[model samples]
Target: MQRIGWTRPTAKTMRDMLHIGAPIFAELFLVSLFVMVDTALLKPCGTTAIAAVGLTAEPINVLEFLFFAVQTAVIARMARASAKNDRNAIHAIIRGYLKLTLASAALLAVLTGVFAVPFLTLFGGTADTLPIAVPYFQISLLAFVCRRMYGAMATILKGLDKPQWSFLLNLIANGINIVGDIVLINGYGPFPKLGALGAAVATVSGCAVGLVCAVVVMRDQLRAREIRIPLSDWLRSTWRETRAICTEALPMAGEKVMIRLGIFLSITRIAALGTTAFAAYRILISLQNFAYLGAEAVATTALIFLSKAYANHDRKAAQDAFSAAMVYGLAFSSLCAVLFFAVPGFLMSCYSDDPQVLSEGVRVLRIIFLYQPFQAVALIYASGMRSCRRAGIPSIITTVGIVLVRPSLVYLLAGPLGVCGAWIAIMTDEIVRCVLLFALRGKMWRQFTDAPTPSPAVV
Candidate 1:
């Protein structure tokens, strides 16, 4: 029988690569669109509404990355489990991680929900923005458990080479969110016009539905053995496994949180520039994310393939996976760059009609064109590094760039260059990050060259 990871690069390999990546891209695109929906829906309530959303988003982004660290850790380990064809190992990994995640999530929900106002205030909440932002943030925090669980399950599906299942489920969740946004934001059909609070309600409601659906879909897959959910030793000690995951996951979580903190601090500075600038920055980020998400999806697909191949002792397969990932990732991001450069106005119009917001958005977006290609490399290589557990240098480098370099440049340059300086600082950070990641590529793959392989048996 031909082994799955032994195939050399060919048209079929490329096709398979795309087949794995496209749904991931769609899922990422939909996630970004979910955020954009909030921004767009609230546009009618004025820029204050937009600013409140933006402020509230930073803290949420930080929290998401905290769980994202867990997801990344899960994907890496699960990929190896898949490669070994060991159902027991995969089950054990999931069970320990999910329990740890649930307990942590419960605590996080309590802390974040209880201190929602103080957290928002620290991020950039003004007296004006607080009244609207606090309730929205608190309500959203209440759904953190469901949202984090949904993400964990989706990561498992992806790690198991079942991206489509998770994508379809998320699409359903998004549909529910859209309906809630339309009716609740404007009080349509007896839904109260709660503005920002309504948006939060819609988001939480979507997550609740998503949690139920993901659990069901994942359960059905387990029954078919497309995924293996073992029923044994349910009360066994998982401390060792849980500790290993946490050790690997904590650095990643720290790196991301540090990066978010820098951005949160930067947001405070931008907010001081006035609401218009703050809102424009938010819109610009969403636009850039449309491009970033594609790279992210391609990176994720590569991570799964590379990790699996490494586990199977197939070095060539890992290399081929990275090559295919970069080719597709760069192509997608390059197209986004072209669109942003050629028709910035058209993209901006999707979110706002205000003349000032449009102008500032265009200026900042054009600046992003210089960084998009480098962004692709950074994301692709970073994924490979993290998958192989070579996260130490990558994490440190990311922290320095996002937390130290970018903000320092912004402080020094934003005075003379205005918002363009902020964008320029971002570009410079990506360029530095690309150079570092490229430099470390060899080290990233070297660790995997001698990795131990496990049995293909259930026990």
Candidate 2:
């Protein structure tokens, strides 16, 4: 039997992890900045506009899970293919998944646009917010395909070990978005002020640019000549790749759906707390996103490294990779925690100057700050399990937390404690999930190390 122990990562291990993680971190940071900038810009439009925009976040996320499901599978497959230097397999996976993602995104966008009013209403959009949210959501759908395509391409780039390229693409896209927000949201010169609608238009424009740039970069990066084959053969290869992708994607899709459902339910409860509370809740959530960005970047790096290690049956490498991810993720989250704890009021002030919003946001932000370390553990371990194709158990664990534990706690707590209670429920859920994931991951590590060789399928 092989032995596995908790070992500290070496210098080389840290460097390699940093090499992969830095770009991913930058990319995620830019994405978060996009949200923060939008929120700040929307301030002048009033809390209703801010709340209206926030109303669209979960619905849009639920819709985007279509892209996310496929993206996860693509990254897993592409990591394996890159490990083997199988250019043909990589090309097939990219083409098949990209086509499917674009079509699905387009279809979902149309349906979402058609049902925008009803969908926003279901998320607890009040009369004031509905008018603003519906049009904003419908307009945002125009960029749905482009945004999804950019995400798909970015994953492919990461799989190919070219994360910097993804970061560069996003930087350009979000720069455009931020500038557009200033000009369009407030109306400058020839452009009329569009308020929340302006933010939606800016998003559409940025996503479109990002998609085009991603295609160009992808083409340049994939310089391999196309394999000439009969149409039947081509179709067969594409179908096989798509089927494999879908098989991996289905479980992830369920996990994502459950998470969004939890958020959806949480939003309904918060929305009932009135616009001030809801808006404050939204701003704090946006601020809290900073805490996760580093952890997510490290998790993505761990996923790619774990995928390759599992594919090659390199258990030691996988162990070291996981260790590096946990360390890096925790360290980064600690920094964010300090910032959250130190100046909760200052951070809250960035989005709104309203005294009540600031007070309410500061209260919840501090609660969220305490759970950042646990949040990091949960994210890294979940990604680790997924990389080994053992996503089912982690998915189930997370689903229970998000679907059952979280909502139940919120339903019980939110009434008496207000927004603070809702966040406290979230914090509890994170700690519970973190502890469970840590134990499960240890068992998984032992199984991998004890096996004579990596199992051909998930153990």
Candidate 3:
């Protein structure tokens, strides 16, 4: 029987994952979709707006990557304690995570606030983009503190097997942001137009609502679970773990930077074909998130299950979880790929009315669909490594493949095939990562399990 903090998910576990995961997938996908919407709506305003928002994205992603790294570690530790039936440990981790997240968020917020413009310039901004990016960047970073807080809280609930609440809160928030998009961007009865600034404001407001809802929903978990965190003990352990998290997380951050830059360069190439191509690519990217969520969900679910198994010293259980999760991920991606082919223009039309944007988006998105299954494989195993607390290696390997191999090929190919060439470059990177990571997955699991650790004391 399941007790306070203990859980031994059976075959039914995967089914639970599906129910809880669907909302999470929706929320995550919509967050990206909102970004696409932000860009698409501003398209009439022009490329300055697109580049303005785009310039700020890499920096925002950097902040999120840091938050996610800590959150990932939190989930792993929380899952370990839960597997060993330690409710007290849940409280302790939450307390520690709360303090750490707040402190980190504040520091980063100050740094980003002070250096927002310079950072945007570093990502390749010009004077025309700066004015638009300035307001967008400033206001968006204001929400990162709340965002990081939500990250820790969401990880706590998800690791404890109450992921549905976390997902629901995010969806609710995104829903608010979507409505705000139309109202604020175009101006409602009394509301004045804010354009890109409106999008940023909408995002911050939505996040505020979501953060409060998530905390409220998980109030029982917070209060009912008794916690006694000793500051001295926390200082010692948190310091060590914090350092270790960075060693692991920095590469993950770097990998994201690689992706952001590669896309940036790809945009530079696509922009040559004019705003229609650039705008088209952005829309297609937003649509791809719907297909991409399966892989993201697999990665997240795999990490939780693997961390639990590794903590319990159950090598066989870990293998079972990984294989079962991965097969489902593959099936999910395959289905999405089929939809992409069968319904080409449907996704493109959501973003724009321009015939060129629609046509180019259809052509490019169809080819990208061919690579979706491969992207799923890469996400599953790379995240499997994260579950084992060995994310660095895979991050490095994929980063090299993406930032170096992929973009270099795109540069070579784009001249001949334009944006289509850029898409091929991305496809090649996903395929390579899929093959390499899958090949190494078994060996890596074996190596990690060879020295499995027992669950530690909870409180």
- Measured by lDDT, the strongest candidate is 2
lDDT of each: 0.81, 0.83, 0.74
**What would you estimate as the lDDT of candidate 2?**
0.83
> TM-score of the candidate numbered 3?
0.84
Prediction 2 TM-score vs. true: 0.87
lDDT of 1 by residue, 1-459 (tens): 221222345666689889888999998888777766667788788888888878887688767777888788889888888777777777777788878878888888789888888888888899989888888888887667888888788888888888998788789888888889888888998678887788889888988999999888878766676655556655667777788788888878888888877886676666677777777887888788888888888888888988888778787778788778878888888898899899999998988998999998898878888789899989888888887777777788899899998888888777677777888988999999999988777777675676555434332
Candidate No. with top TM-score: 1
lDDT per residue (tens digit) for residues 1-459 in model 2: 565555898879889889988999998888877776778899999999999998998788778776676677778778877876766677678768877787788888888888888878887789989988999899889877788888898899999989999999888888888889999999999999998899999989998899999988887787643423334543443666677788888888888888888887887888898899888987888778777778888888988988888777788888888888888998999999999999998999878999999998888878888999999988888887788777787789989998999999988998999999999999999999999997777656754555334323210
Ranking by TM-score: 1, 2, 3
**Superior by lDDT: candidate 1 or candidate 2:** 2
The per-prediction CA RMSD against the true structure, in angstroms, equals 3.9, 3.6, 5.1
- Residue 343 in candidate 3, Cα distance off native in Å: 2.5
Show where candidate 3 strays beyond 4 Å. 1-11, 36-55, 87-92, 121-133, 178-199, 228-237, 447-449, 455-459
Model 1 clashes, total count:
0
lDDT of 3 by residue, 361-436 (tens): 8888789889988888788788777777677768777777877878788778877886778788888988998888
| Candidate 1: regions farther than 4 A off | 1-9, 42-55, 124-135, 185-198, 226-234, 272-279, 352-363, 452-459
Give model 1 RMSD, 1 decimal. Answer: 3.9
